[model samples]
Target: MTKPTEIKALVFDVFGTVVDWRSGVAREAAAFLQRHAPHLDAFEFADIWRREYSPAMEEIRSGRRPYVRLDVLHRENLVKVLKRSGITGATDAEIDELNLAWHRLDPWPDSVPALNRLKRRFIIAPLSNGNIRLMVDMAKRAGLPWDAILGAEVVRAYKPSPQVYSETVDILGLAPAELCLVAAHNGDLAAARRLGLSTAFVVRPTEHGPDQKTDLNAQQAWDFVVDDLNELASQLDASID
Candidate 1:
């Protein structure tokens, strides 16, 4: 077993970890589909769109495509999904506006206060796959108190890619062990752990959906396992005051 690093900064994974993307995207997609293609199941449409998120980026990760911002990937995927839903009448402007749903996501209930508490003790930033613009927009709207926005665009690579996490530590001038990757997903933490960064798994059972089968709980003996960000703040000894 590897000894965990003396944690100082907390680099967060934003999608399901920080903000509630599933609900947010589902809400927006429902509205869009209701207005345009009422026959389609908007909620399921939202789910299917999110399902395409990874494979779209996986192409870039696998060197099958060049690196592009997440917005571009999302737009491409959105169009494909819309086509499948028989909503091909959507204008380019409408498509672009719809894609911005990712930017308008809401934070989980515990995210703001917990992050504020954690911010008292550690340097907190979003180490997300979303680009800087997307993160900045979400942070401003969701009131996420991040000391910095660090992630894929900053490193030009995605998570589990190593370079993403390595560049983040390098940018902070902190050793791998000093930075703890706090996240809801096991894969994200597993990648950080393999790189010698301390890990915290916060369970987000509804991140996928109510009936979600995966990531219902922590999949590893991580440094800290908690129900939400507030518990994480408490576990890390960050005072609410």
Candidate 2:
């Protein structure tokens, strides 16, 4: 395990790590669909809509398209998914409301208490691919107490780019070793580790639901592996004491 000696701040991945995005988005989409398009299969629609995320991101990453925020990507994908599912009559205004669904996701049950504990010892913030406005709005709506919000929009690059991770440290006025990237996704940790940042893997095994195909566990020897955010806080507190 890497020593936490210089670590002064902890950055977290918001979706599926700190927050239950899948379930939260699913619930909201379902409610909206039932209210508006009663004939549509909300559950199937939600799942299909989320399934489009990776491909959409890939398009941007490959330079086949211009870079767009996750919120815009989600909205574009949602339109296609809704149309494919035979649900019609969605106005542009309604689509805009649905796009904001990502902004209102609920944090995991343990997130608040755990973050509060960590906040007492270190500067805690979100280091996510989400844009600044999205992260700020989500934090506000979900009651996530973050000292600051860092996102790809600030650096104009996404995670796995050393620039983004390094820039975050620079902005925080901390050394690379002085910040830990806490995330449920191993790919995210891998990126941070390669860039000399401390890493913590908090397992969110059910994050993708029963059909989970990736990130079952920490794939590398991360600095720490814990059951949840609460456990992560306990370990950090113990280290300090």
Q: Top model by lDDT, which number?
A: 1
Could you give candidate 1's per-residue lDDT for residues 1-241 as a string of tens digits? 3233367799999999999998898888887887888888766887899889889888989999989999999999998887777776788888889999999999999999999988877899999999999999999998999999999999899887988888888899998888999999999999998888888899999988888898988888998889999988886674223
Off by over 4 Å in 2: 35-41
Q: Poorest 10 consecutive residues of model 1 by lDDT? A: 1-10
Q: For candidate 2, write residues 1-241 as lDDT tens digits.
A: 6666567999999888999887877787876788767776655666788889778877766668877788888888988987787777878988898888889889999999899988988999999988888999999988899998886778777676678799998999987888999999998899888888999999988887877888888899999899999998888877778
| TM-score versus the correct structure, for each prediction | 0.95, 0.93
The true-versus-predicted C-alpha distance at residue 50 of model 1, in Å, is: 0.8
CA shift of 206, model 2, Å: 1.4
Give model 2's clash tally: 0
